[model samples]
Structures are given as structure tokens and as C-alpha cells.
Target: MGIYSISDLAELTGVKTHTLRVWEKRYGLLTPQRTDTNIRYYLDSDLKGTHAGVKTLQQRGTNFQDSRNDCGRDGGGM
Candidate 1:
């Protein structure tokens, strides 16, 4: 288990940093934790969640525009 910054997630997942932020802010896809200094960070779970969401989307043959709906919605999406 490790803590990851948004940039780390973007690099590992091939998603842009801005896109991740957008997903977090607009779609509630990621739920990052805050440090005592109020810095945002993610855990291994977030990375796994993203991968699961992507796989779910692919398996369902969901189009890019409609895929967000099926994403776990409770802060568990790509």
C-alpha cells in the first residue's frame, strides 16, 4: 500500500492530471485523502478503482460520453 499524488495516478493510468481533477471535481470519480497540511493524496485503492472502472467500461462497450453513468458514482470511477 502506498500513497500517490494525482500526477502519479495520471502517469500510471495514462490519464492526464487535469482530466483526473475534472473527474474528481465534476464526476466524483476519485476521493483523495488530505494530509495534515491539507495536501491531497491517493492510496492504492484509488488506482485499483480506476483500473476497475476502465475495465468495466470496456467490458460493457460503453461509449465515452455515456460511460460515466455506469462508473461507481459514489466516488469510484475513472
Candidate 2:
């Protein structure tokens, strides 16, 4: 149950922090936990899930925004 910060996720997943924030707000694809200090944190499961979702959508010929929206609608990957 490793908890990762946005920067950690960005480094591990190769997704920009800004883009990830957009996905969270716009698509609601990921729901990260918040610390008492108002810092965002993601669990390992969340990271893996998001990674799979992004890859699946990319393979389906969807751009980032479209993929994010589609994941929201499709429950984030197949």
C-alpha cells in the first residue's frame, strides 16, 4: 500500500502532473486521496489502474483528453 505523490506518479508513469490534474478534474478518471496538509496522494492500485486505462485508451486511437473522458464513461479501460 504505497502512497505516491503527484510528482512520483508523473515520474513513474511518464504523465505530466498538469495533465494528470486535468484528468482528475475533467474526466474524473482518478480519485486520489488527500493528506491533512492538502497534498494529493495515490495508492499503488490507483497508479496501476490509471496506467492500464491510459494505455488501453491510447491503443484505441484516443487522444489524452478523449481517452480520459472515455475512461470516465467506460470505467477506465476494458
Candidate 3:
């Protein structure tokens, strides 16, 4: 079980820390645990899902229509 801070996840995934926070809040992508000090941290599975989700969201780019077009062309390429 890996533990990662927001900075770590951002560094690892190249998804800006602010963007990660937005995905967490706006899309419920990554569910981080908070320390008593309120610092957010993530588990391995959380990071894994967030990593995958970021890839998908980057490709989708806030538009399901574009995503569907890609899917139609590529059979839901991942």
C-alpha cells in the first residue's frame, strides 16, 4: 500500500496539484485520506485510479462528444 501526497501524485502523473484537487472535488476521481493536520494523502489504489482517470480525462478533455468520437473510432481505446 503506497502512500502519496498531492504533490507526489502530481509529480508522478504530470497532472498539476491544483488540477488533481479539482478532479477530486468536481469529478470524485481520487478519494484522499486526511491526516489530523488535514494534509491529503492517497493510497496505492487511489493513485492507480487517479492515474488512469487523468489519462482518460486528458483525452476526453471535458467533452463527452469528443470522447465518444474517439471511442467510435477506436473501440473505446484506453
Candidate 4:
């Protein structure tokens, strides 16, 4: 039940903020919550939806370093 900003999501999920915005607009990837000050924040569930390995790591209590490998950033298909 953690809260994260777009930049935080970008770092954790390895997805750029611009791409995230596109996904949100085109694919409905995330439904972000806004604060009283109108700051966007995302829940932990959103992070999991962005990547399967993130969900698995949370379930297994593993660190996030390995999750990056699952994101197909290393010349693999996502």
C-alpha cells in the first residue's frame, strides 16, 4: 500500500514518464490518484500492473534489482 509519484514509478518500473502518460491516455494503463494539491500519485498495485516481475518480487519479498531484468530492457521482447 505504498504511494509513489510518476518519477518514482519511472525509476521502479523502468518506464519513462512520457511513455506512462501515453499509456494512461491510450491504453488506460493506470488510473492515478491526485492529492489535494493536485499532485499525482500511484499505488503499489499500479506498479505491479506495469510489470509481472514487480508483482512476483513483492509476493516473494525479493529486491527490485532483479525486476529490471524481467522488463526486457536487455534486448529481449517485452
**Local distance difference test, per candidate?**
0.75, 0.77, 0.71, 0.71
What is the TM-score (0 to 1) of candidate 3? 0.69
List where candidate 1 sits over 4 angstroms from the true fold.
62-78
* Clash list (residue pairs), candidate 3: none
Tell me how many clashing residue pairs each candidate has. Answer: 0, 0, 0, 0
lDDT for predicted candidate 2 compared with the true structure: 0.77
Residue 13 of model 1 has an lDDT of 79
Per-residue lDDT tens digits for candidate 3, residues 12-74, read: 877678767766775576789999999999888977886686677677564433553654532
lDDT of 1 by residue, 2-47 (tens): 9999889888876667767767797778999999998789999999
User: TM-scores of the models, in the given order?
Assistant: 0.69, 0.74, 0.69, 0.63
Per-residue lDDT of 56 in model 2: 79
Colliding pairs, model 2: none
Off by over 4 Å in 2: 65-78
Which portions of model 3 miss their true places by more than 4 Å? Answer: 57-78
What TM-score does prediction 4 earn? Answer: 0.63
- After superposition on all C-alphas, the RMSD of every candidate to the true structure, in Å, is 4.6, 5.2, 7.5, 7.3
Q: Which residue pairs collide, candidate 1?
A: none
Q: What is the lDDT of candidate 1?
A: 0.75
Which candidate ranks first by lDDT, i.e. highest?
2
Q: Summing lDDT over every window of 10 consecutive residues in candidate 1, give the lowest-scoring window.
A: 69-78
Task: Please report, as a residue range, the 10-residue window in candidate 4 with the lowest summed lDDT.
Answer: 69-78
lDDT score at residue 60, model 4, on the 0-100 scale = 82
